[model samples]
Target: MALKITWRNILPGCFKAKSPTSPLEPRNQVSKTNSLQRLSLSDISNNGSFFSASDISNSLIGFGSNLHIFTLKELEMITQNFSSTNYLGEGGFGPVHKGFIDDKIRRGLEAQPVAVKLLDLDGSQGHKEWLAEVIFLGQLRHPHLVKLIGYCCEDEHRLLVYEYMARGNLENQLFRRYSITLPWLTRLKVAIGAAKGLAFLHGEEKPVIYRDFKASNILLDSDYTAKLSDFGLAKDGPEGDDTHVTTRVMGTRGYAAPEYIMTGHLTSKSDVYSFGVVLLELLTGRRTMDKNRPSREQSLVEWGRPLLKDPQKLDRIMDPRLEGQYSMEGARKAAVLAYQCLSHHPKSRPTMSNVVKALEPLLDLNDILAGSFIYMAPTEGKKDNDDVDIIGNEHEETEAEKNEHRNVSEEEEAEKKEHGRHQHRKGYRHKHRMRSFRSRAVYSDTALYRTYRTSFDNPKLQGQDIVN
Candidate 1:
């Protein structure tokens, strides 16, 4: 007997199986109202967040739920057949791909370009992730959020389609060497945009909660504007003022809220905490968390929180690349807002709208302050200060500062190159010795064989065959 394997068993990561009905197919059992009665929103919210076979018979938004869906050919055609050259970026879930769909030809498409995310089938549990993203992004629409184009479910292949962001993600722009230096204003705008997106999610009618909000999840467009991306960890915020939504906790380690980490309960304030971490990254140009830092200073939120409180110490936290270009007032306000979000008590944190209000003035404040920062900064011996630790290594030399203070020249680069070459040669020798071990093993085997053969042939052969 031939074994029958359903698509669900074969496909590892898809959230749901598509129905038999197509975009053109007749509504058979799928349109039945009797099954619709069982498909309550409460059922969806309480259990699996998945539709049952009976629920599949009912309509979801406008489409039938049980569609077997995408043909291998259609997916291949959409993603250029999963070409390596079209690959965009890889993540914990899978590789993202850049593809061009002639939206002009598709039935429901408004005629625009679309990007596709094909879940890596090897080791990812991305079907659930894919479902969460589609369900959330498809239903939620906000100016600050990226739009989900559609999805494809066929055979074992699962993919998500999204409107392309030209500038990739915010992490790439902030720290990537190749990325253009985002002016102070652009950074502020991106922060505000991201804030708005989070606010919308937290304050929605049913209040959807974005469980994973990080710099990498924030995508940028052609104009360098920001849009919130990635909703794989999202959940519908508790209905009827339950105060907090609880679930099996899932999120990146550093960006997760402390309370959520201890208890599985999640809330809008959890997102607010993560948002504060992103804001710190924007201001200081440092990662949210780094293990390499001394144990006392590892987590950015913990380390930076103290400095954020004192305006006098804010300069130590500013990105050195900005070179005194940002408004001290704007920077201080940002610092205070970040501190509020990082509060030990989630209730103490302000709403996303409050964050937006704090960041809005900085949109134009960068140029308005301009070179005027020389005057805006409090001069030495100013009495407006309180107990401040002076923040950061104020006495230590900044890279640029050291160059000017010590009068270092081009010779430094040449000296460093020579030192690197010496280290490279040492590494090469170690590698060569490791590779030569096989050859030595073969020679040793030959010698052992010769000795063994001689020993069998003659009792006196051992001493004659031996070599140093």
Candidate 2:
């Protein structure tokens, strides 16, 4: 007599041997159970043959125990039968729906909302991509990385559940015309948070290279805190002295590193370069690739890199929507840091750790401005002084003093320009004469320290908060 092996005994919670149909059950729920029955080993096996216990154990090991194996019916119920009202947004994988899971569905878990992403059968990516997301996000956890709540792998259906991000993505915030422009401080905070996420991934025992790092993949919270999302395209970094992992070139076009695009070799530096592109977007409020822009300015990196070294030209590239709210010194330093990250050679770029250190100080500049800014009332009939405020070391000046200062500064600037032109003409005949352009090297540690000291050491203003 052939020994019978029940699926209930083998897979326990994963499978039910003889599920009785209930009149109260929804039609879709009944179909889902019927689908599970078809995948049972008894139907596939010849004459109900029993399998060795070791075979069952090996198969179960691949399924992560830490992840909750959500049934298709459960997800459907939570998403209100995938109602149109619950639809969030569509991506390459599929459309995401907002869902709420209570303790009734998942015992011991708190009641909270989640974003369920159902895999599109005819989409560009399939089972392999789904499996990659489950295997990576299920294991990696960080404050700056979006949390993976659970996943469903029933029959032909595949879905992922993640913590709902309140503010959507960086791409929407940065590009949407109706959205309020993110304040300079908010942009810096987002960049630092994102860099920390990438740094975490790179510093892992077995490093992970975030092959896809674009503004769209960076999700923001209510407070404008940024979190990294979408692990489908992530790959393990090269191990043990290996420089890079050779793979098919894949990533958003404008953000892919120059070397990574030229060669299939991928490294952690590829992610660093992509971060720089997004940082540029945050700084300048420009898209990586925009056909609407002038032909020469279509590619942001190519058009912006040269301007980063020149403070006078850098202001021209800044986002006009910012309305001169950002500190000039801080913006110049950030531009220099971005230029370094976009270096032609990967090795020349700083590690994510160093990138974090560089950005931390920039945040203090905003904090100081926020805490120390004062709104002074304008004198009657003094329309010119109506909108003026003392910033940094400058004190309020009388109209006469202001005019005199402006005249002197204008005269000095004209003299310098005339002197520069004369020197250029004199050097026209000298073959080896070189004109020095300011670069990242100009941002010395001493200068940065002095800037930080001046901002942070200022006494807080005693009045109503004015700067918004």
Candidate 3:
């Protein structure tokens, strides 16, 4: 019988992280290679078998037969029995791990580097999330979507494995301390790729509802190509001509659409709203909600939503790292697209497909405005989601509170700028001397990839040292 997760799977909220109770050591434990070259296809594929849709899909009617299936023991072994050292990151659903299966087995099975996710054994919440991910990734297929190889359901264990992405997540690249500076062109490509993925999910034939679409969930491959991941909060929309899909409210605080938050009515436009916030992050290089910012400015969506409506303010919103390298036309078009996504009314926003069309020509640096075709007229005098106060729950800050918040943010920004300058100098030094550092020592070894530990020493390290 197929396994399923439910509220009963979740442990009490008081559960704590603990060491694994395994007698066997991990397969390997090598240090990481910082600047590795891509593995050849032959290296990636030693065996004839590999993951595909047919492997996991149900055999009848070709509904979901292409999917791959993984045994629980295989996942445990690949992830060193889910060792804490192999952890990649975590989310509302569970922690992610970086691990490898045997090259011969993978090639024979046609699998590539895979990430494993182990669900927490809490209760109803865990079950719902598990079901959500299975229902969506089990069936959805798109170039921009992350591929799920297989899953494990053994006793209390519930895990899912996916193709590994080297560049990490869009959120890390955009907002984290270890994030790299993305060029304007790359940022635009990511946006376009992400939009296309969402369009596929919300396409006419089988409209899948992605309840949580944010920067963090958008993982990047080594080449910096974006792939949408994490579907634990996803939902399939109601069928037919129904305008909206409604359910219990579930989303990140800053990215949730105003209408959805207020009315509990969801639509593909809800994802569009979150995408707008992500675009703002790409353009401004800011977090959607940062405690380090002044209270009034803590919410990036609240601060930048108004500015997005005006094309002239686009320059200020664009990431300064681009150093004015982006074409004005390109920035303007992006601003307009962002404005549409941020539309207060769900009906007023352009469909995800339409958003993809608007971005198609912008991909080329040369022909940004050459393909500018306006499909929808801008709505005038529209009421914004923040304009209405539905709950009437008043949480006011005294003048003292406001002053304290402002002071804290000012100090934080000062530190960030100071750190930025230091990093810039260090990077310059690295680039100049990097030629001499290129050796087999900098490359990935067969045994190294399988045995690397993902642990972070918390006590002596600062926040910036956590990921690297």
Q: Highest lDDT among the candidates is held by which one?
A: 2
TM-score of each candidate structure, all chains considered together: 0.67, 0.68, 0.65
Alpha carbon lDDT of each predicted model: 0.63, 0.69, 0.61
Top-TM-score candidate index: 2
Instruction: Give the per-residue lDDT of model 3 (tens digit) for 1-468.
Output: 212211211111112323324312211110011012111111222232222221122221133324444666677778887788777877666678877876454445664567888786752247557755655665566789998766666566778778888767887666555423566677888998898899988883547778778888888876667889878767766568887877788777778889888888888889998888788888889887788988988888778878876865665566655445455677777887888788888888888889888988876646221211111111235444332332223345545545555675676577667666332221121111111111112111222223222312111101110010
RMSD, every candidate, angstroms: 21.0, 14.2, 20.1
- Candidate 1, residue 239: how far the Cα is off, in Å: 1.9
Q: Give candidate 2's total backbone clashes.
A: 0
TM-score of 2: 0.68
Q: Which stretches of candidate 3 lie over 4 Å from their true place?
A: 1-64, 103-108, 123-125, 367-468
Model 2, CA-based lDDT = 0.69
Model 1 is weakest, by summed lDDT over 10 consecutive residues, at 458-467
**lDDT of each residue in 260-284, candidate 2, tens digit only:** 8888889999999999999999988
Question: How many clashes does each candidate structure show, in the order listed?
Answer: 7, 0, 28
lDDT of 1 by residue, 66-137 (tens): 222344566577678878866677655566777766543365555555566777788334667776775566
